[model samples]
Every structure is written in structure tokens, then in C-alpha cells.
Target chain A: MSTQSTRLAARFMVAPSVIVLFIWMIVPLAMTAYFSFRLYRLLSPDRSGWVGFNNYVWFFNSPDFWLALTNTLLLVGGVLIITVILGVLIALLLDQPVKGQGVLRILVIAPFFVMPPVAASIWENLFMHPQNGLFAAIARGFGAQPILFLESYPMPSVIAIVAWEWLPFATLILLTAMQSLSSEQLEAAEMDGASALSRFRYIILPHLTRAITVVILIQTIFLLGIFGEIYTTTQGGPGSASTTLPYMIFKQAIVAKDIGRAAAGGIIAVILANIVAYFLMRSIGKHLDA
Target chain B: MARAASPRRRLLTTLAAWFVALLIFFPVLWMILTSFKTEASAVASPPELLGASWTLENYVEVWSRSDYPRFFWNSVVISVGSTLLGLAIAIPSAWAMAFVPGKRTKDLLMWMLSTKMMPAVAVMIPIYLLFQQLGLFDTKIGLILALMLMNLPIIIWMLYTYFKEIPGEILEAARMDGAGMWSEIAYVLTPMALPGIASTMLLNIILAWNEAFWTIVLTTTKAAPLSAFIASFSAPQGLFYAKLSAASAMAIMPILILGWFSQKQLVRGLTFGAVK
Candidate 1:
């Protein structure tokens, strides 16, 4: 019964959270929109002018913008490809009846919980350092020069670190989805003389398609906002060699003090994220029936 | 599917799985191992695995050299404070949306989730400037508020999913017995949703603790959490592998253990209830 009093109480209950989040969303968003048009530099506070579209023009014209865009796409796409593929395979491996399954899971999923900065520094210094790092030592042991990971190969190295951090997450989610698949279907297929490959092709692959999509969308959202790993390792440098979109905005605002340019880049990032999020929400929002 | 396999096959698969698991876990394992080594041994080329002498000096130094305790305290306060704050704001809203009739409830929830989609950097400049104007930059309260708001949508959505599962008849019965809103939640909903609330709190703390981007940006020394504290190690000090590992292990150990406990909720909460 939706009585007047109950409805009133419900409205009251929901208002505080809604109001706060609404303000949080609209305020900064409006400010970003406002600042995108105005030239506001942090250093030169006296210089404020309404130069419409100039900031966006300058932001687009910058060479670093294109470089960061390519790196962003590469990071997201590279991490997505590696994680989803390994996630499926590892999910399959973990789904098998192995001894010490719980221990194996703890080991595999541990990296996802490592804070990004810690993970990156661990990679950068402990493993990827030019001379003293473990990878270097391994290369020396193999009678070859250690490949400078963050220096000569920043993109791939960052991709590897980010992928290492995420592979566990993808594996965990895909494993959950895999476990939900009814084993009876597999048993029946086996009884019908189906080979392991055929059973997997017909049953497991179809079952995993939804989980795969979920992994891609969720990981894409996160991969879009990656900052800590890049920040700690390369600081988006060796000259914008490893710059992601988020780090670039931070650099522009905090380092360069180019608020107008930073705001424009931020708007561009929001549009890119919303594009992926729109597809993500549409596809996965349907599954969230509680 | 559950049939017994040959002993050899079982052993082989077990070996293979453990190898892969350890390979994946090597970085963390190596960090922990390195934390015990001397600085020289830490950087020694053919990197020391077991031959290096172990000592508690690195841990002791890491604790003594910097304001580790302050960062630790800040992390605890921000993570726990934000979780509690998010729960306070989310519970009533989630309860109302879950139990009450409203045509726009679904849309409202989606809108909330979409807010989470807005990349944090997009609002970076505005929030950064606003924090300065509001004098919230690099304060514990400021970080608590930002993280609470950042995580509120997920908290509300998760609690909403939990609240939706509780049969309405129970709450309705409470209302029939003259329990008002406060008593109803205090007595009925609280007890019923305790597990979900607990898991939600755990997940939120883990997230807030690991949050690096904003924590790094907003604060330098005063309000820096373990994230920023460890990030400081990323500078020249990162060359000191043992101390860096020591600081990192200390920073991540608590969340790592908590994360292990919430692995199930990690999937459900992170995917926004899409998979589970």
C-alpha cells in the first residue's frame, strides 16, 4: 500500500543521497564545461578570458594529445585483449578438479588486490630496473642484455604490469561464471561421444560469452581511468611515451598549470568514457535485475 | 565431471596449476622476500632469493624513518570513515528504493551507476580547484568525503541489491506492529541485512584504502594515505629495494587479507551485479 505518509517517508529517505550525488555530478561537470571555454591557468590567476573553442583547439592541436590518445587506446585495448584471453584459459584451468584449488585461487587472485602504485613500483624497480631488476638478472643469466622495459619499451611494459594486475580479476569473474554453468550439460555431451574440444566449443564457449562481455566492459571502464601505475612508473614520460588520458590531464592542470587545456582534455575523456559506458550500461544493465 | 582421474593425471594437473599460480604470484612473493633482505643484498645482481641474510632492520627502519604511523592512521580513518559514511547515506535510500513503489526507481539507480562511469579525471580540475576554495585539500575529512562520494554509488547499488532480496513481508509485519522507520531498520532490516552490510563495508574499505589517484593528487604529506606514502617511495628511494618492499608489504598486508575474505563480494560488487 503506497499510502501518502509512506510515500512521503520514502521520499525523505532517498532525498539526502540523491541530493548529494546530484550536486556532486552536476556541479563539477558544469564547472568543467564552464572552464573548457574560459582560459584559466592556475599560475596566472589574473589572466581569465572568455576565448570560446580556443582551448579545445589548442588541446586538439597539441602533439602530446595525439600521443596520449594512442597510448590510452593501446593500454586499454592491450590490457583487454591479454586479460580476456588469459582469463578464459585460466578460468578453464581453475575450473578443473585440481588439488589445493583454494590455495591456487588465493595465489592467482592476490595481485588484483595489490594497490596500483605498489604493483607498479614493484615492477619498475624490483623487476624492471635496468641493471639490478630480476628481469635483468634473468637476461644476464641467459647471456643477453637486459631489455630496458620502462625506458625503451614503456608501452608494452606498462601493458604487462597493468595486465598482470587485471588478469586475476578477469580470471576470478570468468571462473565464477564458469562455475555457474551446469555440469550436467557437459556430462550429457560427454556421454554422447563428444570430444573435449567439441564440448567446450558448443557448451563452454557459449556459456562464457556473457561473462566475457562483462569482463570487457568492467575492465574497459577501469582501464579508462588508470593513473597510479603510470604515475609511479613512468610519470607518463620518457616524454609522453606512456601517457594515458587521465595522467595527461593531471600533468596539464598540476604541472603545466594550463587549466583551459586540462579542462578541454577532461571533456574529451568524459566523452570517450561515456561512449564505452553507454554500451556497457546498455548491455550489462539488463542483467542487473534484483 | 567429478569422476576420479588417474593419479598421474591428477598430479600432473596439480603441478601445472601450482606452477601457473606461483608464476602469477611471484611478484608479490618476491616483494615479501625482498623486504627481509639487506639493501646491498637486495640490489645484488643475480637477485638474492634465499642466499641473502634476512633481518628485521628494514621493517624497523621503514617504521622509524618516515611517518608510517600517520599514513597508517590516515588510511584507517579515511577507509573506515568513508565506508561508514557511505553506509549511513546509502542504507535508507537503498531500503526505500528496494521496498517502496516508484516508477522511477530503476532509472534513478541507473543514473547513480552512470555517475560512477564519469571518469574521475574529467572532473579533476573542477574538484581540485573547488577543494582549494573550500579548504578541503589535503585534509583527512576532505579525503573521507571525496572517497565516500566516489564510492557511494556502488555502496548504494550493492545495499539496494541486498535490500531487494529481503522479503517485504517482514518489514511490513514490523510496520504492522507499530515499528516506525528508525525501529524498523534498527530491529528488522539491520539484523536481516547485516551480512550484506558487513561485506559492503569490507569491500568499500578495501577500495578506499587502495585508492591512489585522488589520494596522490590531493595530498602531499599531511593527509596522504598509504597510497601516497608508498608513492613517495617511487622516487629515488625506490632504488632501495628492501625498504620499498618493506613499506609496501606493511601498506598492502591489511587490505590483502581483507581482500581474500571478500573475493566473492569482489565479483558481485565490482561487476555492478551484472554477472552474479
Candidate 2:
């Protein structure tokens, strides 16, 4: 029943976003690919030339690259384990008929709203600082030495901060899924002599499977590029102990002024992200048809 | 579902819940509390919970002594400007997809979402070099456009999901009344879509305001937002607990309040409406 003009109008309406996003995706991506093969250092422009595969070979063979790869995996894996486990427990608790639910919910979700720099500063200064930090105070009260958390356990410290930022996200999604579970099914299970643990494991956990997958897949995408936390807290140091892929790229481009190498690393980051995004798109695609 | 448990059990559950909530919220609560304390007391050994000589000096110092207000203004302009710009672009696109039912609309949307999945670092060198060439580096206009592009996909996805819920029959009714396209959208669609628009705006604003990556990376002193401003303190000065708390609290409090209101939309918008 729709006429030609309506269809034309729809095309006109959608054009700006499509065009803007198209350029946004393709132009930078093309430039990155182009630069990866060129010897373009911001500092030494006179030295510029086509480097071919040298940049990628150098980036892949660097010690920092391996350290960053391991650290990135550890950071992503660590935060996922922490957030998902704690998120499930927290979500289950929030789903209970507890008083002050509104305040409790706000309290739990507050960390997610915090900017990364602020969150890093808070933990780095207020709680994780070896001298005046609260953890130090507690250690002293127990007649023990205060550990230099960032120095001694840089990856774990970074993981903790990032996990704090994302815990609420996982909890919120899982809790939403938890609330949608039909009570009648749980009641029937209870009547069949299933214990509380069995009911949760058999009933609630299975119901939350999709939500859990969403949380893991989505969080993995964000966590894979963890930069601000590392930048503000460790600067990917005492050495390359905490340098993830994004931070490594940042150091390469902004600090070292090595555009060619950073572009190479950037392309690698894209490939790594696309793998996770492939699964994420599939899951979201499933929802589209339903 | 509302069947009463024993009083003891209920009390225990409440206690457990509150305890865990506080434990999770402790860092934020401590930051807010420390913001009121004198610098010396802020780092007091065997840290005082409430016994510290509370003062408003840190807030005053953070606000007045440094260029705090300038960074705050930059954050405001960038987040709000980008969101408004994104809304202008997204509303029409989302509206068309929701109403027009073109064969490729789903693919288009998925593609838009895929753009978001491209890691920001993937194009860092290009964007940085482009910004330098275009004189957009370390400027408010530059930051605004970057954040806007960063968030445009979410804005479209959220609006598309919202607009999809408004029945086609309503539009058909408007058409039968002889309203033209512009008039139908102006008179009928805008009013119905306002709430959804507002929710999307709020959520995107929070996202833009708290966005740390581009804001920190792309700007120096002139255009640095609070995120970058706070990142400056990562060195020795960050050890000033009271002042750091004050600055951190000021940077996050507004979005925290906004976030509580938009928690529902957060799930829907972030997961691309898959969970909901």
C-alpha cells in the first residue's frame, strides 16, 4: 500500500547515518591498513618509506607484544571470571525479597557509572596506595607490611578495577533475566522435593544461560580493549607488566611516535575483537528474527 | 511468589544483602566521605570513618584553585553536544527503519552495530593524524564529533527498538485522516516518540560523559575533560587523597544519579535489545 514517495522519503531519512558510519568505518580502517605497510614515524618524517611486512614482523616478534598479549588475555579472562561469578551471586541475592531494594540496586550499580580515570584514581590512591591506603591501614593494624599492590600485582590490580566497573553490568543483565523466570516452575520444582540449591541449579541457572552468554560475549568485547584503567594506574608499567594491546598501541603511537608499528598493532586488535564480535553478532542476530 | 518467610530468615537476608551492597559501594561511599575531610585526616592511619575533622576546603580547592570548572564545562559541552547531534542523525534513520520496513533494514542495523565493535585503538593512528591535519586535535569540536561517531550506533539501535514498539496502525490512522508525511510525523509520531527519545538521550549522555578513551587520548589541556583532568593526577599529586576524592566525586556524581534512572535502558541499549 505504501507509495514510491514514502519509500524515497525513508531512503532520504536513513542516508546521513549510513553515509557517516560508512566513512567512519572504512576511511580510518583503510588509512590504518595503508600505514601498517609504510615506515611512518611522527618524529622522523624524513625516514618515511614503504616497510611492507616489517612492521607486523617487528610487532609480532617484540617482547612487549608477547607480554601485552598475555596480559590482555589475563586481564580479560580475570575480569570475566570475577564479574560473572560475583554478578551471578549478586543478581541472585538482589532477586530475593529483600528490603531497601532500590538503594541496594543503586549501590551495586554505582561503579559502572564512574569514569575509568576516576575509578582508577580512587582505587590507586584511596585503597591501593601502599602507604596511606585503607588496605595499608588494615595491614598495619594486623601488624603486617602493606603490599605495594600495583607494583607487586599490577595485572590483578588492573583486573580488579575493571571488574568493579563491569560487575554491575553483568549483575543487571542477569538479574533482568532472573526476574523473567516464571515462579510457577520454581514452585512446582519445590513441591517435587527439590532443595533450594537444586532448584537454582536446575531452574534459575538454566534460565539465565542466554543472559550469561550475553554478559560474557559483550563484556569480552569491552574488556579486550582495556586501556584507560591501565593508562591511569600503571601507564603499562613498572615495565610492560600491565601493557594490554590497546595500551601497547597507545604507547607505540602517542609515546614512541611510531605510527607504522601502532597501525600494525591496531590491525591486530581489530582482528582479535572481530572474533568475539562474530559470536556476539550471531547471538544478537538470533534475537532479531524472533 | 510473595509467600512470607520466617522473620529470622528475612532479617538475615536483609542483613546479608545490605552488607554486600555496602561492600560493593564502599569505594564510592568512602570517596564521598573523604571529599569532606581535611587532607591530613583523609589519609589518617587507622582511618577514621566519621571522626575525621570534616572540612569543605578540598571541594573549594578543587573547584577554585585549579582550572576544574573549565574541564567540567568541556565535559558538559562534549557529552551534551555529541548526544544532541547523534539524536538528530539517529532519530530519522531509526524512524525510517521502524516504519518503512525496507528489505535491507536489519542488515543495515547489524552493520551499524558492527562499527561499534571495531576497537577504538584499531584506528587510533588514523584519527590522531587526521585530527592533527584538520586542526581538530585538542579542541571541543573535535572531541564532540569523535564521541558522537563513537555513540551513533547505540543511539540508532536504541531508537529503533523504541520506535518499533509504536504500532503501525497509529500511522495508518494518521494517513487515513489525510495527513501528509511531514504533518503525520510532526503531529502524530513526535509526541508518541518523545519518551523514548528522552530515554535514549539520557543514556547516551551518561555514556558520553563517562567516556574515558577518546576524551583522554585526543585532548591536551585546552580540551581535556574531567577524565583526562583526573588522569593528570595519576602521578604524585594523586596521592593527595582528599583532593583526589573531591575531584573524582565531582566528575562522577551527576552521571551516577542519571544512571540509576536509566538502568532499564542500559540493559536494553547495551545488549542491542537482545536480552530484553
Best by TM-score: 2
lDDT per residue (tens digit) for residues A236-284 in model 1 = 8898899988998999899999998889989999998878777776877
lDDT of 2 by residue, A11-94 (tens): 999999999887777899999999999999989889989988999999889999999989988988899899999999999888
For model 1, the docking class works out as: medium
Q: How do the candidates score on chain B by TM-score?
A: 0.95, 0.97
Give the top-scoring candidate (DockQ).
2
What is candidate 2's lDDT per residue for B141-208, written digit by digit as tens?
A: 99999999999999999999999999999999989999988998899999999989999999999989
Per-residue lDDT for A36 in model 1?
92
Model 2 stretches with alpha carbons more than 4 Å out:
A279-290, B235-239
Clashing pairs in 1: none
TM-score of the candidate numbered 2? Answer: 0.97
User: What value does the lDDT take at residue A244 in candidate 1?
Assistant: 81
Report the Cα lDDT for candidate 2. Answer: 0.89
Q: What's the distance in Å from true for residue B163, model 1?
A: 0.8
Instruction: Compute the interface RMSD for candidate 1.
Output: 1.4
